[model samples]
Target: MLSFTPYENPTYFGILAIALLPIVIGLLCKKRFHWYETIISIFFLVLTFGGPKLTQGYALIAYLIYEVVLVWLYTSYRKHKNQTSIFVGAVILAIIPLVIVKLTPAIQNGQQSLIGFLGISYLTFKAVQTIMESRDGVLKAFNPWFFLQFLVFFPTISSGPIDRYRRFKKDYDHVPDTDKYLQLLQKGVHNIFMGFVYKYMLAYLFGTLLLPKLQQQALSAHGLSWSLVGVMYVYSMYLFFDFAGYSLFAVGTSYFMGIETPINFNAPFKSHNIKEFWNRWHMTLSFWFRDYIYMRLVFFFMKHKVFKSPKTTANITYIINMTIMGFWHGVTWYYVTYGILHGIALVVNDWWLRYKKKHQKQIPHNKFTEIFAVFVTFNFVCFTFLLFSGFLNTMLLAK
Candidate 1:
């Protein structure tokens, strides 16, 4: 059987273009062929999760059934009764599979969990968010069919810009007019072209062609060499372009389907501070963490009077939140350290902002200062990427 991961290469896009042509034409005619859309979705899902990856496909199906039932039951319960413990239980149940997947590697000597599938993490985020919003009364109705469509939305099924239930429902339920769809088509084309350059060209150069040579040199040189620095910058570029390119393709495809999915990147390398960097880089994930984890933690701490000062509460929460995020990437020491480093950076960034506000006259604010800030932030971030890359463990610890 022939199969291709979503947006894996130009060939995949060519296949996608043919598959999406009817949907695009339907949208241009001010129509949404729901049946056709669902058909293509299944087709693409099969392409991504089927064939040799059949185990993952089965896992995805089982996970979807599990999550859908969980969400439906939670929504039903939330309608008449709102119990904190029950809500917490529901959230825990929803995340249990993902937790198992993340922990399995460490416990089983790097073995993958059977329940794991591509985008399980992303799916869990969506499911948990849905449950959370249902508890908050933001999501009033939970249609199981629509929920399934949202969950299995093919473009972002493998990875996501992580669409919200309400936002996605709004787009999915409406068909844009011809003029509006024309604009969407224009932006979609532009995004796809840009993605080709970023993913196929630049990412290929940095990740495939250059990174191997740099990695070999860095490994040979071992600790604290110029080659390691080269690895850091090259890997950073590769990570950004590859991920940003994937995001663009996903979002662009969503537009072609007449849904304006959220963007995931915005000139992240140009950010001047760690806080600002989070806002620009992998924006959906950062925003999700802010809204769901960080904000909720702050509220919980404040409600319980856990800390004497707001600053202390925020600083602590920042570390805990980022550490959890790191652990989400994997249950590895490198990932955990990467998260801790970012957490500390965020805390320091907050403190510096406060100090600068109080001593505006003393602290210089000019073009040079701005450039220097960007320079410092970019290097700091790239260094963290080096830790995140696991090259250090390979070089220093491996036999």
Candidate 2:
């Protein structure tokens, strides 16, 4: 049976509270590793790894090994001033673990329980992106400790906004006034409550009440799979509230620590287009893709003989970017479908925009169009979420 056991588990909640204590204390002490803003992130990583039961030890061990190697490589690159080569190397290195995990299904399905809860993907990307930015001279270099802190920040570690180094650095560099800290605490507490409400109240409520019926209907082939569609909508909304709410808590918690981590969502459901939806949804991860993947793809394609002009071959770039976005979610066919669906949507949106621009006098500029666009865009996104949440197969095979 489908279950919401994780959310209801008191032991897990207790562990989370305990894990956050050290981070709170560290913040109170104005903890700065190596007197560098970048180094302070290590403390939070430790706390994050300590949250889960079975995987805590393994996470800590992996984190330690990662910290040692990352520090060594970063320091050597900095000392030799080989910034360009080192940056390229960091981006490549970040992919190693992700590649290994994805290619080796055995690792994911292995008996080792620790491997299952390994939320390494989120941390690894954050680390790699920070290092890449540092190498590009876009962000300042900080010692390993600061990097670790950002990587392991407890609230967002399990799921994340995938914050970049430059923004993180800005937060850590500023000393907060007492009033600011108090305000942060107020917001943090409020956000935590709202997170619970969004998570447990709406998302969880709909999920528990409706999702199992879809699963059953899908199994029994008893109906038209309308239940599955309902579940998809619920799942989509559930995911946002649960994830975005958590990110809000992370932002608020970091704020209290005198670190102004960026917000992750901005009314993403209201987006009229796929591109706009991405901008509002998981804002940090989208930016990460823009900076690390999309930009690189654009440059690479532009350099190739087949794609000389981005203006003429914009569709190619759009397809490549969205496909990469799909792959980033996981090594699954469903994820690929989700990506392709969005890619096509983006292309259509772009064409429509151009058409409207070319015929501005004839295009409708009414609120109705805007409202209709929002409704269509939302349902489109919800349809894709079926693939995202792995309900597509469940719906298809249901009796």
Indicate which candidate wins on lDDT. Answer: 1
Q: What is the per-residue lDDT of model 2 for residues 151-263, given as tens digits with 9 covering 90 to 100?
A: 66554666676776667766666555556666777787776677678777776666777667766666566555666677778888778887776677666656555666777
TM-score of structure candidate 1: 0.99
lDDT of 2: 0.67
TM-score of each: 0.99, 0.83
Please list the C-alpha lDDT of all candidates, in the order they appear: 0.94, 0.67
lDDT of 1 by residue, 189-255 (tens): 9999899899999999999999999999887776678998899999999999999999999999999
